[model samples]
Target: MNGNGTLIHLDNIYTAYEGAAFPVIRGITLSIRAGEYAIVGGPNGAGKTTLLESMNGMLRLTHGSATVCGLDVRRQGCEVRKRVGYVVQSFFFDPLTPFTTEQVVMMGRYGLLGCLRRPGEADYAAVDRAIRLLGLEDLRDRPIGTLSGGQQQKALIAQNLAKEPEILLLDEPFSNLDLCTRDFVSGVLKDLAKKGIAVVMVSHAFDGLPDGEIRIIVMRDGTLSLDETCRPDEVESRVRKASTVQ
Candidate 1:
């Protein structure tokens, strides 16, 4: 962590896809601190997902630098990934995939387990804690592929939480959830932030934010348009206003 408890830092960074004419996200500088709940908002194709990838080193940096957990993002991506948990925009499992919800969540600890090392008591304990936190005890033994979309979403989150990451990045996590489920999931994320985990999420839905001050980041044309802290109730309007500004 930095002097101010900044857990993730990106300095004038540019990220590009292979063979792409230009960077997907350019000249982006961002800092996220422990126990923060930051929402990344923007119109589609505005580079919100790219920014999240840049922070976790999932994409190659074409220019500038990034540091997460005091490690160089480009050179130490493996280590960075261990400390960062990312839940993608969407995921699906075949009905016959065979992994149980408990098994799926246990996968999150694989990176830390190293090759040929099996999970010990600590690993199982962590997985149990995540499952309980996500209220997945009822579905723990069920085949992950058979769950409803919202159930699967909760399972995925539990999987990430099992990693005990310092930074958690989520992309469009609420896309498949109903209002009630959204509220439930939002509360889980809020609790994560309270526990000193940096929670950064990209989402279009704004109705389910927890009651508290939150950070809103709006992107436009691959750059930052707005970055500020505001109460949860003000987020939708502020993001909408910023996104519409020409």
Candidate 2:
């Protein structure tokens, strides 16, 4: 692929926890093109989560360089984050502090709106659209903490999409989801990819994805062990083999 299509570029990256004997990611280099659906797979302690965090500037790079949409992650983290959407595995909100689902979704737009400015009509419209798209109309006015796990996850996705980001990052989104919910969210992601939003996800279930072209990366011993672009069927076989070996 051409360099122009590259949205994420990592060259010789190294990251480690303080006082740790070894780096969590070592001499890693990879690039994700625009509109590509990619997944990172690894056994436990292989730095899959750390790699994702470093891409979004949640972790400081100990060595080498990372660029997202042509912006240096180390130097332009805030700017990079503005164009990127991140969905964590879990939501952490005070259960006692009541906030409506709609209100929680609106918070995504607040970062783009600035500290002093209040959300206007367009912002509210976007929030409503996100809620409707995620099928949260009935739960719109309900307290966020009262929703089920799947509903809460949908709310987080709605919040992420409200930012109108170019790249969406998801870490273990399907880990706690039921089979039906997992299929639903997977369909949503497929639609998002069709709309030309680049997606980079970390998941253990490689077989759950819909049939399409997908890029796969396998991590082992804190290093990139495999990187290939293949059809869904090819990816499944490859992933199965890799997982078995691990």
Which number leads on TM-score? 1
Q: What TM-score does prediction 1 earn?
A: 0.97
How high is the lDDT of residue 152 in model 1?
94
Identify the leading candidate in terms of lDDT. Answer: 1
Q: Please give the distance, in angstroms, between residue 150's alpha carbon in candidate 1 and its true position after superposition.
A: 0.9
lDDT of each: 0.93, 0.83
Cα lDDT for residue 109, candidate 1: 98
Instruction: Locate the minimum summed-lDDT window of 10 residues in model 2.
Output: 237-246
- Give the per-residue lDDT digits (tens) of candidate 2, residues 1-246: 245788889999998777887778998999987778998887777788888888887787899999988899999898788778899865676666488888889988977898999999889888988888778899998888888777888888889888887889998888767888788788888888877788899887766675778999888878888888888868767755564455
Candidate 2 overall lDDT versus native: 0.83
lDDT of 1 by residue, 86-142 (tens): 999979999888999999999999999998999999999999999999899999999
Worst 10 residues of 1 by lDDT: 204-213
